[model samples]
Target chain A: MSSQPRRRRLEVEQIGDVTVVNFVDRKILDEQNIQIIGDQLFSLVDNDGLRKLLLNFGNVEYLSSAALGKLITLNKKLQAVGGRLVLCNIDPQIYEVFEITRLDKFFNIQKEEQAALQAF
Target chain B: MPLTVADTMNYPRDVQPAVAANVTISSDPAEARRIQEEIERHLQARHVSEHDIFSIKLALEEALVNAIKHGNQMDRTKKVYISYQIFADRFDVQITDDGSGFDPNEVPDPTAFENLERPCGRGLMLMRHYMTEVVFNQRGNGVLMSKVFRRNDNGKK
Candidate 1:
């Protein structure tokens, strides 16, 4: 990694055993931003040893395919640890992106965070 | 002779509207954001629908990344050329990179059961779905894509 200090890209909150994460950036479009976000997300699994994750996308208005790639990797990481990851509050347009890629089938997506929290 | 409204609508608007722009940048993906901002400002000025804006924005992000990262291999010395034109009926953009192009057909279907876990190759699928038209040059290093304007939609597209 570069010498630059890692800026906080995620707002984390704990509810019982589940960790809820919200992105600090509205547009997860840039590669560097997505990379940092991916590293931070991985730390939740490797470093923190969190089992279940609830990702709230209410604050995220835009994200690129690279971001989706990161999510897929995160999913794999969670599965390797026998953990789970759920996504909620995705915008309709963003939902369409997942649908187009047929990733909606791969990830556990809920319409609302309340519903998502229940999934975990 | 004067043209009627119906005729005006019928005639294919091959010409670029008054608002058109082109820019070239190093293979740096971050620099692509400046071009995205320019397109967003122009689309908002024309009162393009929100759905349409979202489509263009996402597709552009995918295309720019493909050009900078995959096409140019993140080589900052190379250049990526971007240009856009908005007609009454649609918005069009063309991105060309300096690297040798690869055949888009060789790209595997990310939706296929075996490929679902793959992280990359979904960008092309998003570009094809979001834009009304997406065409690549023979060399595959350049791409031309467009989105037709829409007033309202029930999510059919």
Candidate 2:
């Protein structure tokens, strides 16, 4: 029997000088998001002077503290260098999290992907 | 079939009611979403409100992940158990782990000025904010939290 398909999923891609990570198939972001984002950022950190780390949250429905923690960690890592983390197309519920934590100030959040890419 | 206060105090022997709803997620770090959904389903079945469900789920996920990653040392061999007890006025949850316990006092405050920028350290804060009462049982191996659910309709009571 083919084992049940994997439960959670994440997508990472290189768009121009920016690394666009799309978190998909997962309604919630937790430690999994943290580790994946951390690994992706770390992998791209030294090899490239990343222009922007665009987080496409179009598919993610929920964001937990554990996931938020990773975002904070990623923001700091990118900020240490000249790079910045840009977020776009976040769902309203998920957006509230950024608003509550005041992380919106720390992140360059745009309503559209084009705006995020242009910000870089 | 119903879980009693005394029943909650001790781990189940034959078929632990908590284990009945237990979800074993991966340490792959990518499976965090599954954990949240599982928690939400469990809470919803117990009639938790939509408004409060997210908080309970997030807090529970934080505690569970802490047990899976930090406390259990990310050992996949260990399991994190979550159980629920429905009281007349309140709902309670107990999250237990196989790892050794630690002092909750040592957990750094996430809202503190100096630690504001840190990524972690906010789990317990989120948990406490969502639940009405939070207790760390002696030995600190697990956490028992409860919230009194007031029925707005008032017909059942």
The best candidate by lDDT is 1
Q: Against the true structure, what is model 2's DockQ? A: 0.28
**RMSD value for candidate 1:** 4.8
TM-score of chain B of each: 0.86, 0.69
Clashing pairs in 1: none
Mind giving the per-residue lDDT tens digits that candidate 2 earns over B17-131? 4323444454434454465566567667767566566656666677777777777788877776666655444556777777798888987776665675775667777677667
List TM-scores for all candidates, in order: 0.92, 0.68
Model 1 stretches with alpha carbons more than 4 Å out: B1-16, B153-157
TM-score of 2: 0.68
Candidate 1: residue B19 Cα off by (Å):
1.2
**Model 2 regions lying over 4 Å from their true place:** A1-21, A28-33, A99-105, A110-120, B1-39, B76-81, B87-90, B149-157
lDDT of 1 by residue, B56-110 (tens): 9999999999999999999999999987778777887889999899899999889
- Lowest-sum lDDT 10-residue window in model 1 chain B: B2-11
Q: For residues A88-113, write the lDDT of model 2, one tens digit per residue.
A: 99987567666655566667899988
